[model samples]
Target: MSRIILHAGMHKTGTSSIQAMLNSNRDSLRNNDWEYVFLPKDAKAAYGYIHSSPDSCTYSEAKKELEGIISGSDCKNFIFSSEDMTAALQSEDLWVSKGERVSQLFESLGNIEVLIYYRRQDSFYESAFQQRAKEGVPLNFKETLKRLPIMSSMDWYSKFKFFESCFSDSKFTYISYEKAYGGIGITGSFLKYASLNDIIPIDHSKSDNASSKILTKIFAEYGPILDPHDQSLLSDVLCEYERAGDFRRYRLLSLEDRLSVFENYYQSNRNLYSICENADVVDLDIWRADLLNEYSNDYRNAVDDKDIIIDLLKLISATQK
Candidate 1:
């Protein structure tokens, strides 16, 4: 029977890089008997079906659209990826039914490999928030704390259990963001998972631009005042100032708060370790050690007042020019 590799990403875990690699190597993957499946219509329609209500007309339309993609594919084996599927895990009210609906979409494929790459809850929260902050949204530290549980609640066991309950024949494989993202990086890690590393040469040159925590804090604090065009210009300037790494890292949560957040999901994480394939891959020890040692020191809680004023003036001057 042909197989399906469903890379249902827990977002902010290098999902884009993996998808880019698949798109870049489409011909090679096709030659290897594995086709990367992309929904012909709105790419997000696949995720829309998962969140759409069964009572609504959208649910049926989305289901039919998704099913069409699978049935229409010329290749018997496929690799489908969508990070937005992770959003269902956060919806306690809908995850089970959503999982069931999704399982039906893939029932024709006899063998299913559910691939997930997860980061520690605290780091995941910060990284997710930074993405929003960069989009000119105001950041609230207290609100960030309140949102911590939502992140922690997305524990490995619960997510895998959702799949197990929904798809009886599916096999689960979970990898930590730290481990999978090593010298070879997440794209390479995924290639290794598909057993294509040796045959598929990896291009190590592509990488995400360096993001400065200092600029992130500035965006969070001053985003609303800037016009959309100015914000776009500032974003370009940020990329040019990638060397701003010398500045103190902007932190939303203190070491104490971050540890508290991690501990909230500690037991559930440990429980997952027991049942997870190659439990050693989820290295909580190294993660905790880095938190307590390398990241324990107090860091800038906000962008420096002087620096912020200077940066804003510079932005204004550049935009006015």
Candidate 2:
């Protein structure tokens, strides 16, 4: 019997953590009849076996390698994960490119089960901004989003719907990150999702924590503003920093602004979960109420008036166009 579990992530949803667990616990999981299968060394690392830039020759070779692993192993369960599959965007038509990746993947792997986690819109935007900063986009939350419309679109329902059309046969299980946190936590929830809670131990000792590298990307992006010597020295200092850090994690968008974005996805999210439009899975209403009660007009955030001014200028420039 052969079984495949594809954990395609919707960025910023603890994907690196889940992939780390799979990489570290491979042997232990193999003992439990579960295998974290391999693709090309680069593909396994950067993207789930699905390549970012797809080619038939590369995917074909990978398919051969994967089939060999499946043939030799007695394990009934296999996992391959890379959430950036649907998350990352380079152009307006991400679906065509990513959808091609999925099509190539299905052609290679044959019948397989796919699992994806859908994160709420507002939280996804905040966390994704941090990720973009890692890739050396130093703009603030609002600006980065303005540049990346696919991200700002917050169109999870349409993306997932496309996935359904692409891999319609595979068993689909949707995990709510908010719901998962309130219950068995991330790793625990994954094990439960895989039905391996009793089989494989949830060990995260060696999980990859890539957050530390954000400073390097940020400094690199600011290279034009720094001298060569200063840039090198800054890199050294950033690497040794005692703690993980990102752009000051302050409120980037106003609550009213965030709510407006959330409204775009309200019906989409409800459609995904088969819940009523008024029901909140992302807890926006609850989070909004609590935040409003905690902070007053006197509460100042780290976002500077200058940054707000820049945002306004950008908006003004856009409207004129």
Candidate 3:
């Protein structure tokens, strides 16, 4: 019997890193007897289908692409990874009912397993806010953080009951971004399920790209520090910056500030975390601490020297390359 694994992302959870590694090591994965089907421009294809279909939330075009992949390949195991799936769930109204869509999609596949990763609400909201700013959304961190409910509403488990209803406990797994690297046993368990085993080398290269809380604060306060003409170029480079887990310069809110923010979303955030805990999702305490540590370290090591600006400029230039 064939196996189909669908890795639907909850976003801000190292999705890009995983996707990049998979795409970069496709040959190795194939040699290990696994067939990987990655849409060259998965986001474009996903958005194309989403925007084009006014009546359906399901990306029929993307689904068609999946159909072609399944039909064209004879591999017994197939993997489909995309963070957009989580977005789709969040905007459930845009798609047909969740139950209907899941049933229809799964009917076309063999035995299927669903995987997702969850991040802490506070951390995800902060990072997502920075990301929105980079994308031309003129939202400051405060405004972005204030919109947590709207954002968290889109997470897969939060919006779609179909995923839980359709798949057994054993068929679904949730991982935390905190345990994402090294010879981590958590990652080992995840890979074991995919049957990738030890055939693939662990990716030790730290993510150079990923939103830095400090950098985000800097941009928020000073406006685009990079050359305006290079905004587009810098945006490209910063795309991966979110994965770097580099949080040097970002200061955590004071106890009062943290309490205030938590109070604002007390019920909602609690419920969200509760759902994750119930679903066996790994907690993100470790990751949150790591982010804070990086932020503090960056702030301390930050220099007001011209060399720092020069380095930033160089990073922008590299993005254009």
Number of the top candidate by TM-score? 1
In angstroms, give how far residue 133 of model 1 lies from its true place: 1.1
TM-score of each: 0.80, 0.70, 0.66
User: Residues 1-321, candidate 3, lDDT per residue (tens digit)?
Assistant: 568777877678777766766787778777766777653364344444544446433457667766666667756677777666555554556434543444455456677777877664555666676676666554455655556554645344445455566454326666655555333433343466576768675535544332365555545544444456665555544445555645444443443455444455444544555445533232346534654576566645443435534666688767567
- For model 2, the run of ten residues with the poorest summed lDDT: 240-249
Check candidate 1 and list the clashing pairs: none
Q: Which stretches of candidate 3 lie over 4 Å from their true place?
A: 39-67, 95-99, 135-137, 147-157, 160-162, 166-170, 181-193, 206-211, 224-247, 252-254, 260-321
Candidate 2: misplaced stretches above 4 Å?
Answer: 38-62, 87-94, 100-104, 107-111, 134-137, 202-249, 275-291, 294-321
For model 3, state the Cα shift of residue 305 in Å.
10
lDDT of each: 0.69, 0.60, 0.57
Off by over 4 Å in 1: 39-48, 53-74, 147-152, 204-210, 224-251, 278-290, 296-309, 317-321
RMSD of each: 4.2, 8.6, 6.5
lDDT of model 3 at residue 19?
A: 74
